[model samples]
Target: MGAGRPLEVDLRRVWDAILYINKTGCQWAYLPHDFPPRTTVNYHYIKWMTTGFFARVNAEVRRRVRKKTVETRNRVRGSSTVKASRAPQNLPKNPALTVIKRSRAESIIL
Candidate 1:
């Protein structure tokens, strides 16, 4: 199944089946008929899990989540500081102020 073109199973469906089996702790033959044949699902589940697909997916997801959380925290911190700065409406703004604003905006996008 791993060579050439990949198999046709829907990843989400397979994932659901994996979750179901894990949750129920059922024998492979006992899996419901609504999913692929129990043997097919079990084989794919074992192959993927043994080959580290689940661990890779989990690590990538966690890395992205942590990065987003750090970005959000930084934005909050900068916003508070900017609020304190409160440049006067009538005065010419400092060039450093423009640079700081631009950097903060770029950081948010990242």
Candidate 2:
């Protein structure tokens, strides 16, 4: 009785619509008809983005993953961990290209 329409939009449906747009990489105008209206989903997406909701969620997820990885590593290694050397391991010991230093006296004037 209080509202004009009885909250017809479902937030979960809107979320699914947003996910569909992200997965398919399609324009808002191309959003499928199965989900809530594109305007509804787009509005929620913009609101969340502007309020830093996605950034906070991403940071929390990364923190949890890093903590779990460290815990697993410590448990498996038993406190004796080997750290990598300062130099990167991927480089070849003998490089293909070598620089030859030339002095002023060595210059051949044309």
Candidate 3:
């Protein structure tokens, strides 16, 4: 939810953090400090659990393994909300142009 501070956690690290939490049955707050903050991992996990994402991932992996086939499609994907940036970086600075510009202009007009 980006409630306090937006997190930029790696996907692999987040999964490892989740596995640590689940396998250990530790309280979310008590997650090892070396992993991404517990709340961040929990936030993502709850979101995925709610959206049936884990089911899809499991099914895909199982199918690939059973078939002994290389993945033709991506193995997993987060929800649209999860993929959304903390801030909309591509918003148009000059709406009339229908063009997005960085805070600092690409070039100055004479």
Backbone collision count in every prediction? Answer: 0, 0, 0
Best by lDDT: 1
| Per-residue lDDT over 15-110 for candidate 3, one digit per residue giving the tens place of the 0 to 100 score | 898888779888888888888877778888999899998899999989879666444223323344456756677875676454445323555532
Candidate 1: residue pairs that collide: none
Q: What would the TM-score be for candidate 1 when compared with the true structure?
A: 0.62
Write one digit per residue (lDDT tens) for candidate 2, span 1-110.
58586677897898788878889998999998999888888888999999998799789999999999999988768644444444467876443333222333345441
- For model 2 the TM-score comes to 0.55
What is the alpha-carbon lDDT of model 3 when measured against the actual structure? 0.75
Please list the Cα RMSD from the true structure of every candidate, rounded to 1 decimal place: 14.7, 11.4, 21.5
Could you tell me the lDDT of residue 2 within candidate 2?
82
lDDT per model, in order? Answer: 0.87, 0.80, 0.75
The TM-score of candidate 3 is 0.52
- Give the winner by TM-score: 1 or 2: 1
Candidate rank order under TM-score: 1, 2, 3
